[model samples]
Target: MDSSQRIYWTAFYTKPRNEKKAAERLTSKGFEVYCPTRTVLKQWSDRKKKVTEPVFTSYIFAKVDETSRLEILKDTSIVSNVRWLGKPAIIQEKEITEIKSFLEDFPRSELAHGDFQAGNKVQIDSGALSGQSGVIRRTQGNKAFLIIASLGLELYAEISLNHLKKVG
Candidate 1:
């Protein structure tokens, strides 16, 4: 592929509860899409059942070149490309791989939104996210929610306290 056709993994926001549909539509149109999902046991008054849900509620990633990027916007389910600093946010391939590996290893993990407060900077000393540095966004019990910022996007993960060391 030429420079203009070089594929980039770009993040996009989908309409509410339309992640899977958007992924399917984009894939059918020959776009490589990744809609990370995990299976979890959901309990209702009647019974418990396993359900698969998107890891990122309304977000999906697509591999698109410069021209194809615009084409994706034409899809009704796709709200728009995730932008940071007035440009499309390009996600790194390694980060996407890490997310997939994390979901496989921790299928029951939960994603939560916490207050965006300034906190100490720390580096992961061990485990899957080892060597990654992020600000400790929040903490509850033994888990610390970290915001790892890259390419103007924030990747949030709840990590064990034992795996982090406060950066000097």
Candidate 2:
């Protein structure tokens, strides 16, 4: 296959509340799709229900080549492929594995908005997240919570102070 036809993971934006539907359709068409979701206890005045919600509200990842991307886009539930620098945003395999492993370890972790001062980038020099760079969302004493944005989605991970260093 030509370079443009080479397979890679790309993030797609789905219509509101259609993340699951989009993923299911893509998978049925033979595209590998990843839609990480978590079950949470949602409560109301009269009852509590366990609801499975997308980790990244309206986004899903799919493995497809540029040649088949148009087919994916034609799915009614999918709005568009996420773009980075005017091209389809490609997700690294390692990053995908890292996110999967992270969710497995911390299934209920919530995504947080990072408010680090401008120009601050933190990299984990050691630990499970070693070599990963992210923005520090918050800190408590000797621990820090990081927000990593990859493939158009944001994920949160907590690490000890010593494992992190300001790089850029």
Q: Which candidate leads the pack in TM-score?
A: 2
Q: What is the C-alpha RMSD of each candidate to the true structure, in Å?
A: 11.6, 12.3
| Candidate 1 C-alpha lDDT tens digits along 1-168 | 688787789999999999999999989999899999986555466765667889899999998898999999899999999998998888999998999898888765343212223497888989888999999888764478899997899999999776777786
Q: What does candidate 2's lDDT look like per residue over 108-158, in tens digits?
A: 533222223333588888977788889877675446788988778898887
lDDT of 1 at 39: 64
Model 2: residues >4 Å from true position, as ranges?
109-168
Model 2 scores what on Cα lDDT? 0.80
Candidate 2 vs. true structure, TM-score = 0.63
10 residues in a row with least lDDT, candidate 1? 109-118
| Segments in model 1 whose C-alpha atoms lie over 4 Å from true places | 1-3, 109-168
How high is the lDDT of residue 102 in model 1? 88
Candidate 1 lDDT score at position 34: 97
